[model samples]
Target: MRSRLAARLAALGACLLLTASCTSVSGTGGRPRPTGPGSLWNPSAGQPSPSGANAPFDADAALRRIKRLGFTADDEPGVLRKLPGPLRAIHSHCTGSVDGHCVIVLFFHGNDYVGYDAHGTGNSSVVSQDGTTVTLSYPHFKPGDPMCCASGGTREYRARWTDGKVTFSPPLPGNPNYEEPSP
Candidate 1:
């Protein structure tokens, strides 16, 4: 019985050690790793997190709120991707796109809809974020280039969230194919 008890204690100790090791984000000196984008703590985009922005995201609530925004009633709003940062952000894909691009990153503060990145041209679909800047990559078309294919190298634009809204660093790309969503 004593041997069995000793084995159980040893197993428990091993499990605890593994857990501690996994949870340790400190550096060699036991100081927490630098706090920044890649740090274990404060992984936000280096901006002061908005109020209640770190709260857990409630998908149902977000969906309900988004529906009221007059975006669409036919295309169901769905999460395309979730971004990492101090603020909870989701790249939502749904309908009601005027520029033919149906994806945009929606920002949320504690499941409450805040704002979203600017609409993308049909060519721009790749989105990424660094710090507080969101970048969108799209095919670049030189004069005379066909609409389907762009021979000019890809172009990228960045947008930043500030004062509770998204502002494009450069002006939004102009889409000749833009059309108003039919009522």
Candidate 2:
């Protein structure tokens, strides 16, 4: 309908105005505008592309931005609960037994990569685009349970992450509690 088209154009025009003022994309209607050369279009030219690991890692800044979007710390649980999710503390071959399953939770706390829980004690890992290899300084007496504090957990893990699912060694230790990110 013409009204809908006009509304879209109006919305687009307001976006252009905000972009012309070199506004940060962290407020109302906060989508990053595309970069281009026109006076009203190009907010930053020849500055730096704004993405990737090289980008500044500011947890506070990120947290502030996230909060401004009306999200509170407690809201995280509700949002996550609403979504059918992955990245849960679940994975097979967790025990590191000759045949046992394991689970690991990985998160980038402001780009400092950490992996823990349901797996080995957090140490010695090589993760690449191709795959992730987690080697424990000592062998895990129990593959997935780290709190047991049973010492000397050692192993070389060759893990392949496909579509978010992890498949390490076969017979991948069946577990009622284990779930991998959908590969």
Indicate which candidate wins on TM-score.
1
Q: List the residue pairs that clash in candidate 1.
A: 44-86
Q: Write one digit per residue (lDDT tens) for candidate 1, span 96-127.
A: 44543454445554444555444333445436
- Which regions in candidate 1 have their CA more than 4 angstroms from the true location? 1-51, 64-82, 86-105, 118-120, 173-183
Best by lDDT: 1
My TM-score estimates for the predictions, one after another, are 0.44, 0.23
Task: Determine which window of 10 residues in candidate 2 has minimal summed lDDT.
Answer: 83-92
State the TM-score for model 1: 0.44
